[model samples]
Target: MANENCEILFDYLRSILYDSTPTQIDVHSLDEDFQKLGMGLQFLDHAINELKQCSTALAKGNLSEFNPSRDNFLCDNLKNIHANLEHLTWQAKQVAKGDYSQHVSYMGDFSNSFNQMTEQLKEREEHLKSEAELEKKHAETVNKYNQLLLELIRQSNDDVLITNIDQSTILYSSHNKVRVEQENEILYYFYKNINNPCEWNMKDKDNRYYHIVTINMEWQDKPSFAHFIHDITQEKKEWDRLHQQAHIDALTQVGNRYYFQDEMQQFLNCKTTATLCYCDLDHLKYVNDNYGHDKGDTYICDFVEILKSNIREDDIIARLGGDEFCILFINGSIDSINQKMEFINEEFSKQVVDYPQSFSYGTIYINGNEDTSLLNILQIADQRMYALKRKRKMTT
Candidate 1:
């Protein structure tokens, strides 16, 4: 059985060494040396058995002579086997210790197999190491982008909101929250879904009386994030006040000469059909004399209200100066102006029953044949007003 095993190991060695085989030899044949493995394990067993037999022989005072050639052969084979196995054991330790780059140099030409395995392992190890380094660098790059994105969001002054399109409310800015009214349900909904840089007009729930201008914009590169809101109530009020002041007489709170001038210029420039009715108080100083300057001022204020009530909203009525007033009847014919004047004259006549208020006025139309400028035409109307006042005084 030992002989068969030894022959098997020798065949493996021979196949690698020469890549051929001796098919003619019988493994159990006696001429082919009957040897076990050349490692000292078998040699030790044989040596122990021999020593015992020799001891017993010697005890009987008889012994077999030892052969010098056999002893030399056994020791040489054992030394070769022990040396080769110890070298193989050292190569295995290098491989198992993660030194896949390690090569097992042939101790006596038997290490070629181990060398091939180590070379392949070394190639795989190099690839794995490179892959690991790339992954580490990629992870670091992603972390940096995340940090920059967070920092940008925290630093923005523009109201930014984050929300899902489907969700009723995801997140809103504190700036927006402050402007939200008690009854505002849509504000929350709008904040979530609003696309940025868009204009929207909104009303707060508590303050539906005022309009709030809202601006919305996209907040991030992601679709999940959107922005909203503007509170323009105060701005609108200020705008209206400024607009009023532009065309109003500050003291009397009526339309001023500047407004009348602008409207006349617009009419003339646009070639609009219109008539002008110019009126002047006949004796404003008489009231200042009979009563007081306070009564005179009261009389002027009362007359302004009457003028405002009598004229159509489209008509431009203005105090040209202290005691003179101008009216531009938009698209009115001479007949229309006459009818309106007659009505105002009837009302003014009634004021004489209790109040000392009387006025004289004249009207002019932009007839196709008239080649006069609006300013010159106003001058002509002024002359006509005074002429009528003089005629009325003479008749009274």
Candidate 2:
């Protein structure tokens, strides 16, 4: 009976060590020593079964089932693995929440991989934040510049406007309403030639003049124009006043020598038929020597008034110098000119002055086909006047 019990124990131990299916031992039929051996085999089976359960729990990622204090080697390793895995899981969650400071110390190659992933994530996050800040600053700068530009336009004396190509929509305007009828026409012309800058004069309802300038531009991603209408009413008036002062004689308030030359050149260039009359105050130097320059000036002024009264409005009269004067009559007949000259002489003869207030006069007729220069014509007239003056002096 002892031999049979021994054989059963050996068979069960062999099966437990190397067989796929372990054999069972019957302790009730064995002696006390064999029964003790059977109890030890059962304890080993219980320990292996517990290990299998722990391994299955670990494979399924359940760490609570593993215990290290109960065994050595395999169980202790599993315990350390479970703790490391739990720590790594917590570190992963921290990283996910934007905490790149989390690190693994004891996960071998996985520690290096995790740390590298965190570093890369941190760099990417910082890059994105920097880009976002730059974009925000750019947007703010653009807005500030736009505001300043708007205020400048609003405060300027020059009218500023921004509009689309069709003029259907007005984007911005310095003035609430357009002040001129011609502004719309100018804007239309600007749109037709958008590539070129346009400029023109415009008059407002108050008769004020403005210089309009239109420049092509893009606004809000659409084709548009910026119209600058500068007020030039005062400038125009000032210019006209200056122009008049330049042409007018300061002393006589009539055409000066410069104006006469300019007009004569124009007439000559046009080949206009005209008559030029030259007159010299008979004794201007004598009057100035005896009665002072004031009296001579008065005499000159009186003679000019008489000439202006007797001559037609179309004729140009000019004071060439202190004692010389000239008149240009456009297309005048010689008979009519002679009659006017006689009338002027009679009027001057009636004047009562200490010195002679009379003037010596000569005339030259200019045909449209004449090839004579202005200087030659003036020389002939001057010679005739001097000859007539000499004859008058001798006769007197």
Candidate 3:
């Protein structure tokens, strides 16, 4: 359309110029007065009309007639327009081949309307490239974290599992079927009802015990979770071993220091009005002198066994140390205390079974005068034990 319009204007211009043209249409320096110029009044009127139409087009930002041709669309700097089209064509080819880096850039000095448009496309390309790089880095980081998580899963001893707070499955240990199912059941139902320290104990179908500890971790915050369990079989075995150890004397297996002290405290609490019988094997040192310390030790242990067998299960008998021993009478009444004393005397008189070992008896009554604080009471009982020793010496 613009080319046709140009042709039409040029044709009209030729008609007027040929009949009465401005061989030199300089407005000033015309070589002739305005009335003498070619086309005279008729040419002046056409020139004025053409100038007004062009001016109107310029003011409306449409200085040329509308034509769809690419060449006519070049409003300014034809070189810049050419470069822009080449860049756009290259970008299109790259897009077709799946590359996105080609972008339009005109010569810096060629500031034109095309420059603004290409600069905008350049900015958009840079933004997209940056966004793609960020996404790539994020994916790499997530892959690394997942790799580390996979390694950790391999090394764990307890059956580890993860789940949503809503009881949806996330992950679990591979080899442990019975435990995972049991633990999953427990965590599914119990965690919400209890305080958040959500803990439970389970025995798997394998009869293996596990102490499960559940902890909630924040992620997408839709109650994603993790769990750990500890197998307690070895711990249970140690406990049983310790429990057996706790009740027996290391040397004699009668009662350990702990058991003896516990029994003493309980006996004292309940049997207040009781007699404490303190005894020592009579000639233990003489035996150590004649035979070796080994034989003397053997004699003492044998003596303790005899005392234990002779006493009631309710009776707490202990080897105080070396050759000395102690016993408590739950029956603290005078008759009962005396009867226990008589029995010990009778056993002393009768014993010599194989290797002779007899103990001297010392009886102390619970009464108004003795300082009965545990240690003091034992001290008082020992003192009375020595006085009984003196009487034995006289009899011997």
Assess candidate 2 and give its lDDT: 0.80
Where in model 3 is the C-alpha error above 4 Å?
1-154, 159-228, 235-250, 262-276, 328-338, 354-356, 361-373
Candidate 3 lDDT score relative to the true structure: 0.61
> lDDT tens string, model 2, 1-396?
789877888887777777655777677778887898888876676565566667788899887776544654446667777888888888899999999999887988988998999999999999999999998898789789889987887777777778876663568667733454545654654555553568767665567777878787877668887788888889999998998888887777778888889989989999879889988888888989999999988988899899989888999998887888899998678668867886898889798877766889888898878787889989998998898899999999
lDDT of each: 0.63, 0.80, 0.61
Q: In lDDT terms, which candidate is top?
A: 2
Per-residue accuracy of model 1 over 27-105 as CA lDDT, tens digit each = 3442234433323333444454454444454445342332223564434544454455555666678887777655656
Q: Who is ahead in lDDT, 1 or 3?
A: 1
Query: Comparing candidate 2 with candidate 3, which one achieves the higher lDDT?
Result: 2
Q: Which residue pairs in candidate 1 have backbone atoms (N, alpha carbon, C) closer than 3 angstroms, thus clashing?
A: 196-216, 196-217, 196-218, 197-216, 197-217, 214-230
The better candidate by lDDT, 1 or 2, is 2
Q: How accurate locally is residue 277 in candidate 2, as Cα lDDT from 0 to 100?
A: 92
Model 3 over residues 1-396: C-alpha lDDT tens digits? Answer: 445444544554565546444233333323333324334434544654444444455446452432223332223343344445556666667655645444444445543444455566667777988999998898789779867976776666666666665655655453443354676565554454542546776654656666777788754335656666677767867876897687766666676556767777765666456667877777788888988788887776776766676777777777666766777765557567657666765775476644555667667766534435667667877887788789878997
Question: How much is 234 displaced in model 2, in angstroms?
Answer: 2.3
Clashing pairs in 2: none
Report lDDT (Cα) of residue 48, candidate 2: 59
